[model samples]
Target chain A: MKAVLEIFQNVHMALYAIVFILSLIKYPVYKNTSLKFLPLIFLLTLVAESMGMFINKVYESPNSVIYNIYYFFYFTFFFYLFMKVINVKKYKNYIKIGIVIFWLFYLRDLFFTDIFNESFIESYIVGAGLLIYCIILYYISILQSSKVLVIKNDLLFWISVGLFLFYIGYLPIKIIRSWFYKENSFFWILLIIQFSLVIVMYLCFLTGFLWMKKKS
Target chain B: MDEKEIIIIAAIAIPISLVIIVIVLFSVFARRKNRMLQEQEEAKKVFDRELAESQIEIREETLRNISWELHDNIGQLMTLAKIQAQMAQEKPEMMTEVSETIGTGIDELRALSKLINPEALKSLSLKEAVSLEIERFNRLKFIEAKLTINGSVMPIEANTQIILFRILQEFFSNTIKHSKASTLKVVLNYSEEELSITAEDNGVGFDKSDDFLGIGLKNMKTRAQLINSTLRIDSEEGKGTALTLKYKFV
Candidate 1:
């Protein structure tokens, strides 16, 4: 069970690294502003994950604060990514407002409410907010577009799907982590599920980067 | 079930349900988008077919006009020139008159040649084409036809010009054949953004309500819509028929 968990974590981290490297190659060719930030975000995630893993190994304590800081970067990067891709002007403002609200609640929880706890409150808020943005992206793309002729080849479509699957699939688990993490079997099952979702999400991102050509 | 088990089951159930919902929504949107594309392609096909049909109709109409002009006007003029030539042999002084008569026939044939040349007609601007039609009317002594240009002329797209010409041809055909009009007037008004054409005839016009669908009005309206032009027809029992067409420059 420990081996399987370790393998899953390793694969998840490797996928993140691959996506980051792929973004670096794609950045120059595409010259897309949204893609320019992806590599930096991925690198930040890797560093944060490594720090959390090292802290846990040496001190034998859950590195909640490392992830708490990572979540802040996660929310910030995705917020910027969503703001760039969202087509409607009104929806862009809405996403900006939503991000502001999420940050306010996240900062309040981190500093004042639960300073030392691994509550996953910020994850829940960021997850729910990102889920809504992903759904809205899909909705607006479908509504405003005359033809989603090759949706699989569409970068925005794939990106939204990846974000939607990862956030929504993991949202319930994040919400109930406090209760569920105590059960060893359930905890492993949830981790496996989360890992699977992460793998699928990264595969989607990879496909978008490799196969989806710049729209002329 | 314990609270823990219930929580586990609910957690599994909710995400699965959400995944199902997302899949369903995506499929529905894909289907709708495909349907819309199909409808757009069908509409384009119909428009192309109609445009081709209108082109053929216009060519046939022009051919019929050329045949009529040759038989009625040119044939009679040539016969007169032949008679004059026979008399000019005896009276050398009349040779100049005979030559003048033949020259007139040649000029008429030359004018008719412009109508027969498909390439010339295709390259002809809307203003030039309309002016030629007016000139033909005057030359034939059919009616007191007059063409008035209001503003500086602008070039129109080729396809749009063809459609507009066909619509105007239909109107002129109706006016000459049905309406016992003595005078016909055409006004071409060019504005900054649009071109407006008004054709009016002093004819014995019918009731507008009754003759709304008379002749090729419906076809004209359809062609106008195809070119994104607005067409208006006004007539009463005794009032002359007036057709106003406004086409915006795109």
Candidate 2:
């Protein structure tokens, strides 16, 4: 059972790498749009994951610091990109406010939390909530635009879906993880679910790379 | 709650929420996609209906033209020939006059038949169709009309041709019946990317804000939009009316 779980985890990690490669392959297609630098983010994520893995498993050191920095850049770029893509003036302003709110959370982590040793849970939760709001705004903008009819071919639409699904599903698990980590069976189950979420998220990214096209 | 029970609830609840989220996302997009497709289907139906109506109107107008020609033009020629034949029975010199009149009538009949033939009409390109209309205007002395082709002719989509033909037909009809224009000009400039058409008439134009031509012009604009193009109309009182349409090659 442990071996099967390990395999699932490895497969999920491999999926991220495959999705990263696909992003590189398809980078030129979306290089002109706001996603011009999207491939770099995937590359950043892959590196972050690999480094975190090495630190935690090989060096037996905490990986939270790597992820803390990774999350900051990832969420910041997405917030900025989503703001660019959103069409409404009011919602764009709201996203600006959200960015300020996200900044406050980052400031809190920098000032109060032990970012090098522990997960930035407070800011992660706050940022994830803001990210969800940003995704909602993105959805609203998609509805307003003619892109609604042809979102299947939209690369950013798929990525947004992947992020929205992962954050939303992982929200409860992140909250409940510390309370239940002492229970081995529960931790294993959480690990499996988390691995599945990663696979699902990367699968969406792969689909976007394969099928994505500019608005016709 | 005890720790063990809370763990149990959290484990069960996490998967359930994920499943619910997936279901909601699935249903939302599916519903949106279905609605979009339905709108497309509806637009297609409306276009088909408009196309059918325009075709019927064109046929009716053609039949009206034929009736007028047969009664006023061809029928008169035949009567003149008959009168000349009776006089030729008296003088034999009138025989040539009767033959000439009969020949003119026969030529007119042939032209009308070509106009009436569905196959000929179906095979007519937009350029040819507009040229024929221009020729008819000049032949009937309705107005001094000319059609100029600038670039090499290109094949337009069949449905697009029909819709464009109807728009121009409406313009020509208005010029003849309402514009009281002395000169009507149509220019078709075809390029690799698009076909730019401008049809103008030097006539008593209307107010820019006039709703008198609103319904007709609105209908024309709607049809243009249906074909993913816009019909730009420029007119002024004591000036002329010019309609410009730029249709991209599909």
Candidate 3:
């Protein structure tokens, strides 16, 4: 079981690296599309993840600040995409408010609250919830659009599916870690589950970059 | 309340929730696929309906044009030939002119007979179809109609051609019947990825409100949609009216 857990842990970041490399190779396919900057975000995540590991190991300090900033940008990128893709006026307004709320929370969590000591769990939770809501709204918009006919070939749909699945699976894990990590006895199992979700999420991203050549 | 109890609860609950999420996602995917199939079926039906209607409309318009030519132009030629033949009884040179008039009337009647054949009309390509309409307009002196085609003519699907021709036909009818313009212009530009058709008439254009959307114009809009093309109709009161349809080849 420990060996299995170790394998999951080691595979998580490697999967992200594979997706990052694939996103580069497929850059021209989506260069003129709304997903043009999506590869850049993947590059940013891989760099941040490496930097986080380096800081935690070399400095013997918490690496929460790096991830806090990374999550902030991640949430912002998805919100920007949702704003562009989603058409419903009511949902658009909700996404705008989500952006504002995420920004305000990140500012408060970073400057006013603990920054380097612990990860920004509360703000991250808020960001995740809003992103999930935005994705659902985007799905609803796609249902009403002619785009649904070509959903399989659509890059945005694949990316949204990846985001939706990973976030929904990881949200509970995050809650348990933040609220009950100190007292939790099944922490290893949850960590392994979290790592598995990361691997699946990266695989989803790789699938999108590899096969999504149809213009969205 | 104990740490061990909380851990046990979470382990069981998390996987259960994940299973539910997976089921829900599967259902959503299934529903989206069904909706997409329905949409494709709906589009196909609309295209077939529009094609049949446009074919009928073209036949009716051809009959109208043939009737007008037979009564007004060809009929006038026959009457003139009869008077010229009577005059020829007195002058030998007038006989040659009377024969020439009779020959022209025979050619006009032959052209009308070809139009009366459904097979000949069905075989016309999109360009040929539009050319025939322009020729009829100029021959009838309805307006000084001009068709300017730029770039090599790319082959469009027959179904798509029907919709495109009908849209331009609607625009031409409106120009001749209501515009009171002396001239009408049409351009078919074939680009690398798309075919653009533009028509304009210098006339008393109508207001840009929904009130100006007649059934003919609305039908044109829907037909363009059926073919996955864009139809834009722009007009300024008293200035002129212009229509542009862009159809990208798949």
Each candidate's lDDT (Cα)? 0.79, 0.85, 0.83
- lDDT for position B51 in model 1: 82
Better of 1 and 2 by TM-score: 2
Worst lDDT 10-window in candidate 2 chain A? A178-187
Model 1 per-residue lDDT at B5:
83
By lDDT, who's the top model here?
Answer: 2
Tens-digit per-residue lDDT, A1-216, candidate 3: 768865775586687688878877877887787788887788888888888878876997888878988898899999998998787898889999999999988888878778887888889999998989998899888877777766767778778888888888888778877876653366877777677677767777777766676563
Q: How high is the lDDT of residue B141 in model 2?
A: 78
Q: How do all models score by TM-score? A: 0.71, 0.76, 0.75
lDDT score of residue B150 within candidate 3: 93
**lDDT for each residue of candidate 3 in B61-91, tens digit (9 for 90 to 100):** 7777788889998999999999999999999
TM-score of chain B of 2: 0.89
Model 2, B139-175: lDDT tens digits are: 7778999999999999988988888888888888877
Clashing pairs counted in every model? 0, 0, 0
Ranking by TM-score: 2, 3, 1
**Ranking under lDDT, best-scoring first?**
2, 3, 1
Q: Give stretches of model 1 more than 4 Å off.
A: A27-130, A133-137, A178-185, B1-3, B18-26, B71-91, B119-250
